[model samples]
Target: MKALKKIATSLIILALAAVPAFAGQQGESSGILTWLFLGFIGLIVVGQLIPALVMGFGMVKGVLGHSDDHSHKHNA
Candidate 1:
């Protein structure tokens, strides 16, 4: 009947769609040296970031203090 035709067509489509999944090959992993190099790079980045943040915060504090120093107009 008409319903049977539609069911057969859907099953054919589903089977074709699943072919790629069955064809996939497993990948090999990079080993420990890759991890060690990545860790070393991460450390270098973090080390640079800490001093940059401290200097940024110090600049912000200095700017805010300059604004507060406005009350010392009489000192001029």
Candidate 2:
């Protein structure tokens, strides 16, 4: 009985691990949940990107020491 159990377990594992080997393209289109999930992920990416771009530009400004506000003080 132990040997039979071991064989059954091993067969199940083998079948599971090789599932992608037989997986093919789905014939149906994706559902709304899939599009919603993709949109949520997109929003997350864009939300993080905006702040990163702003910070990057700030860093560039600091490194270059370029400021336009100094013109008013220079005029004085």
Candidate 3:
């Protein structure tokens, strides 16, 4: 049952991913709506990219042993 559920979820994700491939292909109008659609798509792309970029930067920092806090203790 779990395997079947996983397969169904994967198929649903794949179907949703393929939607953009068929979008705007048969459309005849190229007006404000087109620009709006494109802007929305761009926003979605950038929204995903920002978190990915942050995570990537954090990973790189970890691999390079970079940290903001100093480990030394100064006693007065």
What is the lDDT for 22 in model 1?
A: 66
Q: Where is the poorest 10-residue window by lDDT in model 2?
A: 67-76
The RMSD of every model to the true structure, in order and in angstroms, is 19.1, 17.7, 9.1
Error of 2 at 43 (Å): 0.3
TM-score of candidate 1 on Cα atoms, chains taken together: 0.52
Model 2 pairs whose backbones collide:
none
* TM-score of each model, in listed order: 0.52, 0.51, 0.48
Error of 1 at 25 (Å): 11
> Across residues 1-76, which tens digit of lDDT does each residue of candidate 1 receive?
5986899899999999999996776787769999999999999999999999799879988877745445555655
Model 2 misplaced regions, further than 4 Å: 1-26, 66-76
lDDT to native, each model: 0.86, 0.87, 0.89
Give candidate 2's TM-score. Answer: 0.51
Best by lDDT: 3
Q: Tens-digit lDDT track for model 2 on 1-76?
A: 5986899899999999999975776677889999999999999999999999799978988989965675554544
Where is model 3 poorest over a 10-residue stretch in terms of lDDT?
A: 21-30
* Backbone clash count for every predicted candidate, in the order shown: 0, 0, 0
Task: Judge candidate 1 at residue 51 and give its lDDT.
Answer: 100
